[model samples]
Target: EFARAPGTSDYAHNTFVDFGGVTAKNVRLTANSNWGGMFNQYGLSEVRFFSIPVFAREPSPDSGTTDVDVDVTLSFRAGREAAKHDVYLSTDEQAVIDGTADVTTVTEASHGPLPLDLGTTYYWKINEVNEVETTTTWQGDIWNFTTHEYFVVDDFEDYNDYPPDEIWSTWIDGYGILTNGATVGYPAPDWNQDEHYVETAIVHGGEQAMPFFYDNTGSAAYSEGERTFAVPQDWTKHGIKALTLYFHGDPNNAAEQMYVKLNGSKVTYDGDAANLTQTAWQPWNIDLVGFTGVNLSNVTELSIGLERIGAAGGKGVVYFDDIRLYPLFSAVVGTFSIHPWTGDGDSGISSSKTYTHTGKFTGEGTDGEPFFAGNGVYFERDTNRSGTSWTLTGAANVFGTTNPVTVADDSAALARSFFYGDEDNNHPVLTLMGLLPNTEYVTTFYTVGFGGAGLRFVDITPGDNLGYPTRVDQNGVGSGSGQLIKHTYTATSTEMSFMFDALKTGDSWHHYAFSNEAVSPNLGSN
Candidate 1:
């Protein structure tokens, strides 16, 4: 119940009450009495409702903005009745009142010099508060923003070509068979334009979107759109690991085949390829960790092609807009190895393998749970306490970020050897349950703890196993990378085990033990 004098004696005009942080879908004001009358008839001047701070302004990242700097300050306008403001920031969209308001400032409000995760989305809101009002808090609507890497592949805002008229492969849906090119420019209209016309256009909050056509009618086996783009920067040096974009598909059109080409190598979609949903405009993200072999740096050209393989009538059209590239986060890391071999008829045959995996390593202790891998290999923590795993901390070197792969330079640049000990005792362990009996197998791992300041590879888990003296082949530098310790051997029995125990011995440890982790297990054809 907000109260006021009800009516003004000065021209009877300035009578109002301020409600700080309250909102409703519908508001009904029931007046009891005023200065003009006792109960029935009352004089009221004006009423106003606000879902947000009445005068909120100057959002740091800006509403619906992208490519925001990692270290950004968030600020907003001062409320009309606000004595102070409660500000909140979060990566989670549905978060509510977690007690973690980034900052609450007087007069308008500002928070930061705050650090942000790279390649991530953030949601923030402001709530106005008044010390003297009956209601001191009025929460506002949530506003969102996203942050990107220092490097930007393309925003699609400025293309020297103006409109990519010649880029779309229009001949496919009989689009090329006709004449005036396939893909066309979509410039969003301001007013209520013709909905039936395909060109009234829906842009991704931009001036234009390049849309392609697909007929799949007569002689139209497939309806797809393809266009090539010349990458502007050397994203490889910038640690690019993910690709993102905005897409639009007609609700009337069903699932279709969608594929993308990076430097000519076909990289399949993470989702179902046969069912590319063409609904409202949405963002799609693709992680590059699983991409076996793709050169991200010095990337000259990229081609995007979509085919309507399962459309009911054989043809349909789709729209794609706003493509972006990103670096990895601190939580995601990849460590891998390359094996080039020659023998058996193909002497020059060479191939490489990567050991980077995306999975959670919780501290479960020795009595924790265990699960089997796709290869029927059962694995568990080195001990019962979840504390046995490697520690995540700032590095002694400058290559990585507090030992985070996704936030570091690249997979190879990670320094994984930060530990709490110099002793050879306590270490993280993992056992592989399914290995062939007496089978020849070679395993290579970039073990960090073993070769610390003065520690030997033998100091850690060398010839490590469930039980028994296993065959110890060799331990040495891999590629120009002297840090990667390659250990090979033959399986004496079925179950194989490994461990990370640099800190257990209580031996003198430094910032150098255990840089990062990369493992490779190869069972030669027997």
Candidate 2:
């Protein structure tokens, strides 16, 4: 007879026994041969019994058999790897049972084994299967035991679900909150308002306990003339998971400085105070991962304090609101998408000559007049043929025309009013007047040929003759060497002039912009 543990490989030097008709003896087994090393190949030896012998006698006394049920408990060790286990029962060692498979696997590192039959010995084994690969398996020694028919436990209760309570706050002023009352007695700040001021409210003890404090007040000791708040010593003990803050900048002051202690170490966040504007509120969210000293495994507490690090007149204020502490699986990052405008309200248009709230130009006013509440500009195109030569039909009022293109032809068509430059000529300039001075503007037009084009700006004094049309392109050819191109110019002058000439050639619709300033005077004005 031969018996071996389940899943054990039939390799060299495994324990084995052999019985020929009467007696059995221990034998050394190897991959190549059985006992006596007789055969070069190995195979299992079968045993048959002429008469069965009882190992032990059952207890008498006319004792009736009693059945009992016992619950089997299972536990696992190891971090993530130790939590997985498989339980199985079998009677006939050679027969495989399909429906009896226990599919309810436990995810927690420790779990229970349920009730089992008593008075009858049952064979059970646990397999620590690798989660990443199911085929790789390891088995524990089989356990045999009998259970009592019935057993009960008193300390059994259902699990309960509770909302997460841990919370973390970061830079909690002006970035998100708004103050309502005077400098002294303000109610809990509002989040909807556009303005924010510096202050803190004790959420746990009720407003009466710690009333809010402001940076300008004398009670809060000032460091370098600005108030500061530091994280509590027991921050980590409270189970804080995340942090949030509200911040505002002071355009005149130097950057602000704030420090926080995470997991017993202090880290600083340098605030950009010079860029702060009172007109709008900007919210900031800081993740615990943003701090290296903090133990994010289970953040307990966070401390925040601020100081004026900038120049003396660098006073800045921010409002704080919606301070929170909660447990979350992961942090969220911000994302942005580039939005382009076509004639339609939707984006992703296929045409090269598409217009945004700002217009695309082919000639003059090809795009409709500033419709839709004047959110965009109009464009025009003119490729009129005067005998063999070509001259774009000039418009009297560039902005006044509804549909600027007068000529209609597929090859020589005037689609919209756009400017083009010729590399054959020095970069001439083009200017449009009657524009808002010192304001941002976007001037877009198409040019053909030329790899890239440059802009030349000239400031025209009031009452000066500005009647100069700079050449954008010398020889305006569609294919041979030059074609359509685009250019943009940003002008910041009170009165300026612009003209376009080419630096190269390529037949494509181009778009450029002049932002943060206005356009200059036109070529015709003096």
lDDT of 1 at 256: 47
Task: State every prediction's TM-score relative to the real structure.
Answer: 0.31, 0.25
> Which of the numbered candidates is closest to the native, going by highest lDDT?
1
In order, what lDDT does every prediction score? 0.43, 0.31
**How well does candidate 1 score on lDDT at residue 122?**
84
Per-model root-mean-square deviation over C-alphas: 22.9, 26.1
| Tens-place lDDT digits, model 1, residues 273-354 | 3223333344445665544566665464555555445433344456666677656522111111222211112111112322
Going through the candidates in the order shown, the clash numbers are 39, 95
